[model samples]
Target: MGRMDDRSVIVTGAGRGIGRAIAERLAAEGAAVAVTDVDEDTATGTAAEIGGKAVGIHADVTDPGSVRAMVQRAREEFGRIDGLVNNAGWDKIGPFVDSDPADWDRIIRINLYGVLHTSQAVVPVMIAQGGGTVVNIASDAARVGSSGEAVYSAAKGGVISFTKTLAREVARHGINANCVCPGPTDTPLFSSLFEGNDRLRDALVKAIPFRRLARPDDLAATVAFFASPDATYLTGQTVSVSGGLSMV
Candidate 1:
């Protein structure tokens, strides 16, 4: 049997990139997955690709009402809530002082507030079900402070702190909370940050210790480990899956 046989999981932004990889990995491990995205078509497409144990739900994680509905839909379709992967995030690349306030607000709403909304909506279900896991997809920028990623890093930094506090608060209830910090990765979601410029991408990749950009599967594997039984004893920590890019 697979590691997550019969388990129910929710993976946000699962229409593509790392989120899609995570959803696919969990499904391969026998989990019934609820794949969520703001774009309904891609979300459903991903669910179909993963097989019958998955369903697609369209949601805006930045909106509390939408998140509540997403959680409810997951419970209704899967019968239980075993895990939540907060992998949906947004950002704009620029110096901290150079960024517009509006950009900061937009990034924070999706990157930080979205975590809050989803976790709050799902925790009650997880608690009643006896236990659950939360894996927030943070960024290496949160740890090492990347240039041009000030707000994004700050928002993810808050998520790291939030992971620890939430873990402490819910350990008694059997819920695990943690984060995975990915380095510069090759995901469609990252397209915006690089502006579709191959030269810039090459420069970024050369800087990494691995001499290549991280793939979505790399992030997915790390997240899968966190959700697996092997990680039951682990909580409140951040695993840097950055190919030794940010070792601090």
Candidate 2:
């Protein structure tokens, strides 16, 4: 039997990239997944592709009302929510000094506030049930700042800290919260960052001890581990899946 058999999970921003991979992995492991994304079509498409107890719902994590509705729908679909994966995020690369304040607001809203909205809406459900798991997808940039990603780093850093505190507060209620920090993974977002800069891409590859970027499946595997029974004793921790790029 799969480790996550009979479990139900709600994954935000699961329409594509790393989030999609996480949903696919968990569903493969026998978990019924609620794949929620701001893009309704992508969400439904992903759910259709996974084809197992997965259901796609339109959810905007930045809005508490949307998040609450998403959580409610998941419960209605699966009877109980066993896991929550906060993986929806966005970023624009550029000099911090040149960054627009408006961009900063948008970045913080989606990256930081999004997590808060989902956690607040879902944690109570986990409490009502016996236990559950929370996996927040942060970034290695949060641990060691990345150039041109100041605000994004700040937002992810907040996520890391929020997760730790949330973990402490919820542990007594049988809920485990953890954060996963991914290095420069080979996602569409990463590709967009170095579109015309092969030199920068090659430099990054050389800098990484592994000589390659991380795959979406790589991050997905770690998330699955955290969501499974194997991680029952772990809580309030941050695991970096950066292929040794950052050893802190």
Candidate 3:
């Protein structure tokens, strides 16, 4: 049996990237996982690869109703939720001065509001069950500003603050809420952010202390740690998995 054996967890944005890696990690640790994404096909595809222990649910973390439904579906499938990983987020880069309202809104809605939506939905269930763990996937940009990611950085920074508040407020009820901040990672989303420029990607690799970009699994491992019993006393904190890029 694994450290999280028999537990049930939900991982949002599992359709791709770090979210998909987190879902896979949790499942491997023997948790009944809810692999959720706005795209049904991709979510189900990941769940299938995680074996029969996972259930795929279509969810838009920015939507309260969809988030509620996701929580309901998790309980229905696994009987209860013992953990949660808020891995759903989106971003667009440009000078904040000229950034489109639509892009700014989208980033805030998904990266910040989604954390609130998903956390509020699952906290009650976790409370009812005595306690649970929550891992919010934040970004290094949130901790240290990025050149072209002003709004995105703000949203993720909000998440960091939200996590601390939520962690303290719910700690008495047996819930642990924390965040994992990752630096540049070699995921499809990372490539998408660079506009398919191969040289730019190489430049990014040289910027990190490790002389390499992080892997989705690298972030996933930290999320999994925060979600596990090993971190029972850990809460109201942000753990940076940025390959020594940001030390705090």
TM-scores for candidates 1 onward, in order: 0.97, 0.99, 0.98
lDDT of 2 by residue, 186-246 (tens): 9998999899999999999899999999999999999999999899899999999998999
Worst 10 residues of 3 by lDDT: 195-204
Give lDDT tens digits, candidate 1, residues 116-191: 9999999888899889999998889999898888989999999999999999999999999999999988887677
Candidate-wise lDDT, in order: 0.91, 0.96, 0.92
What TM value does model 2 have? 0.99
Tens-place lDDT per residue, model 3, 1-248, is 89989899999999899999999988899889999999999999989988969989999999999999989989999899999999998888778898999898999999999999999999999999999999999999999888899999999999999999999899999999999999998888788889767897788788889999899999988998889999999999998998898887
> Which segments of candidate 1 are over 4 A away from where they belong?
none
Worst 10 residues of 1 by lDDT: 188-197
> What C-alpha lDDT, on a 0 to 100 scale, does residue 9 get in candidate 3?
95
Q: Which model, 1 or 3, shows the larger TM-score? A: 3
Candidate with the greatest lDDT versus the true structure = 2
